[model samples]
Target: MTEQPDSVVNDPNNYKLSYRKLILPVSLISAGAISFAIPPMKELDLSAKIEVAHDRPGKTTLDNYTQYFPAVMVYGLNLAGIKGKHGFKDRTIIYATSQLISAAIVTPAKSLIAEERPDGSNKKSFPSGHAATAFSTAHFMYREYRDNNLLLSLSGYPFAAFTGVYRVLNNKHWMTDVVAGAGVGILSTELAYWLYPKMNTLISGKKKNNKSVVVPYYQSKGVGMSYLLVF
Candidate 1:
């Protein structure tokens, strides 16, 4: 006779949960709160003015680096086969929503603030878009991949920091702009995570426990050898 599964297996608390169970909605709400709170600080205006006055040229290189890093990171993740699995889809949703929100907020805010760029050019600078994008992407990576390994979580900080640095170095934005941008990125990621539950149910699926084995083969001096291992 076949053995019956234990009653504990069907217990409500015994089911496996996805990473989204805790992280997704919480992150979203947190991002929203931060985004709402950052815009009214008075010190940002003073710092922005100082940065614009001292701005110089030839710093476009930093801007270039900042602009391309997100694309590179996305490509790297894809190559690692991490995308489309293990919260990849959720991350993509976060990125897309963040991008949209950043663009919507930054463009209009820049125009309205009329805060001159660090380059001292026209008044189209307030909250650096590049910095915002970088932060958003970094936050997404952190939330999605941090659970996979600690190194991935650690890697996000440097990228987010550099994005702010590049904006300042390029003289395209002030310290205030970079700070606000960072806030925007973080907020966007959190919003995405929060909305994920209602937006898509695929993210809620649970994985089954399984095991795998691998075998290796080598050829030398016209002889072949093979080895097997189980995981």
Candidate 2:
């Protein structure tokens, strides 16, 4: 019997590219982009009708701050002796890079689109920043705790959804804006995951003919992965 070559089985370069892996993210981003061109998307009469019942009756006056709660919960859980998917260094880099990428996408798009807010506050309402932060944080929490505690991992989404809902209820953003923001947030985190592996290798000076399989470092002064920013 012939033994299979280790390089053939274990090489990252040998991995088969699959379109199935891209379906979810592509569909989500497409939904967001298509909303801009389609008539009925802007004509979301249902959302407009719901907006009339506005103002969170019992929620705190500082409701906008709720968007950051998911991220806080991630660290809180870590401090509470919960082991996440990554260690301190990997998680820190991945989470921070995710947020950084989100800011990059949201800020420039906001300036370019310049859509007016629901309450006529300003023209930076095309994509909801609160929703972006909420979802990105939620995804971070989800990725971290998912393998350890499914319930805790799933809990992040509701918090993120609530933030988006609050944004709409408070007349800060439109429904489409919320949807697009969600897409951006999710995509940002996914991109970070892809990039971190490569970035780690690059930063660690571990490129031998540029063919090394990227790995996360576990010790001080060790190299980590580079984050891929794929949309």
Which candidate tops lDDT? 2
| Tens digits of lDDT, candidate 1, 8-89 | 1123232234455536434533443343367744355456556555774455555545543653565366555654223334
Q: What is the lDDT of residue 1 in candidate 2?
A: 22
Candidate 1 TM-score to native: 0.59
Tell me each candidate's RMSD, in Å, in order.
14.4, 10.0
Pairs of residues at least 3 apart in sequence or in different chains that clash in candidate 1: 27-190, 28-190, 28-191
In each prediction, how many residue pairs overlap at the backbone (N, C-alpha, C within less than 3 A)?
3, 16
Under the 3 Å rule for N, CA and C atoms, how many clashes does model 2 have? Answer: 16
- Root mean square deviation (Cα) for candidate 1: 14.4
Instruction: Give the TM-score of each candidate.
Output: 0.59, 0.74
